[model samples]
Target: MATPYIRMNGAGNDFVVVNALETAFRPTQEQARTLGNKATGPGFDQIIGIEPSDGADAFMRVWNSDGGMVETCGNALRCVGWLLLQSTGRDAVTIDTLGGLTTARRAGPDQVTVDMGRPRLRWDEIPLAEEMQTYGIELQVGPIDDPVVHTPGAVSMGNPHVVFFTDRLDDGFVRGTGSLIEHHPLFPEGVNVGFAHVLAPDRIRLRVWERGAGLTKACGTGACAALVAATRRGLTGRRATVEVDGGELQIDWDQATDHVLMTGPVETEGTGTLSL
Candidate 1:
């Protein structure tokens, strides 16, 4: 059958979304690899599926471009929230994900906000290979005499991430150093590597190499991870504007609730039906 699909992007992180709440539609990893390929595929960072949820408005299921199923994608949550809001005429909606339940609301005509939940800081939670300090684990790149980047702050925003604060944004540092650390031995489940340059206490220029998605224009969870990590290290405040390759996202780590809030925009690039 021809299943309807919505093509959406938050900032520049794109997705191919399908609704399976009323139908029995399961996405295979093979399809993800095909749909996420830029040269010969549909070209998306991830594939999102909306399914029936007993706990929330919908359950968000995602598969990375490398055909790996993952727990969270924050931008996708905002996109789904907006879709439900548009359909139900409600400003707020709760979404169930592999990560957990996330509450989202309309912030503006083109902007949406999602509470990403508190970050997981424990080594066991981030699922590091061994017990160590997550803030600065025993990991490094380059020569021992002078490493390119080291002592990153680790945190899990439903997914593992290691954030490196650099003095400047270098293409070599972001790509080269990020790639090596993604598969480092310290992270048992692998990790997303982030390169961030602090423009101010409330502003950062960031880039991420996702666990299975590779390099993306923007990663919502990655942005949240960056903010929480930076704040924990006293580098930034609880709130900041993260400028990714795609665009900017306003992030805040609420002190009272300890939940991270992400605000951004989602665009409907186009709509079509997919043959499955």
Candidate 2:
């Protein structure tokens, strides 16, 4: 039998969403990889599973195309929210992930706003091996002497991220630098690496090499993490526009609520069914 699935994109990070609520089959890493293989399978950056929630609104599970289980995915969550609205006919939807509970609201027909919760900045919270107070610390990667770009602001949006600020938006350093930093010893569990260029007090351009997913078109949580890091380092303000390869996202760090809000567009590509 074929299991029905939905294809969607948040910003430009594409995903394959499976409705696990009515299915008994749980996709394994191998299965997910087979489904996400661009050349031979379903083809997607990540595979998302929607299951019934215990106490929260809904339960979500994320799997990278490489077959690694991840804690969260902001963009996919928005797509999940849209699916929930379609199923329940509700404007506001709450979904639970291994990271935590996330709330999403439909702003327009295709626009969704998500409250991704507060960021974790402490070295331990960011889960660094050691303690560091300053936003910019010292670390070395390859032969890039005087790598002044080290010691980035670290944060967790239910996932780990290290953000480095640069002067130019299109600097080619991100691919090489980001690859090395993603596996730096400092992050025992590894981390997603983001290179950002501040275009204005309220705008920034970013590129990301995700921990398990490698480079993606866009990463919603990554944008939030970058904004938080930029604000902490005084590189940008509390709210800003994050331009990723795929599209732009509006991010706001609410002072009163102490949470991060990410607003962006989501598109439904097509729907299909999977056989377990």
Model 2 per-residue lDDT at 198: 89
The clash number for model 1 is 0
My TM-score estimates for the predictions, one after another, are: 0.96, 0.94
Across 81-175, the per-residue lDDT of candidate 1 in tens digits comes to: 88998999998999999889999999998799999998999999997999998877787777998987778889998889998888646676677
Give the top-scoring candidate (TM-score). Answer: 1
Model 2 per-residue lDDT at 247: 93
Q: State candidate 1's TM-score.
A: 0.96
Which residue runs does candidate 1 get wrong by more than 4 Å? none
RMSD of model 1, in Å?
1.3
Residue lDDT tens for model 2, 163-263: 87875445356666777787788888788888888889999999888887778899999999999989998888999999999899999999999999999
Span of ten consecutive residues with least summed lDDT in model 1:
167-176
Off by over 4 Å in 2: 142-145, 167-172
In model 1, the Cα lDDT at residue 27 comes to: 61
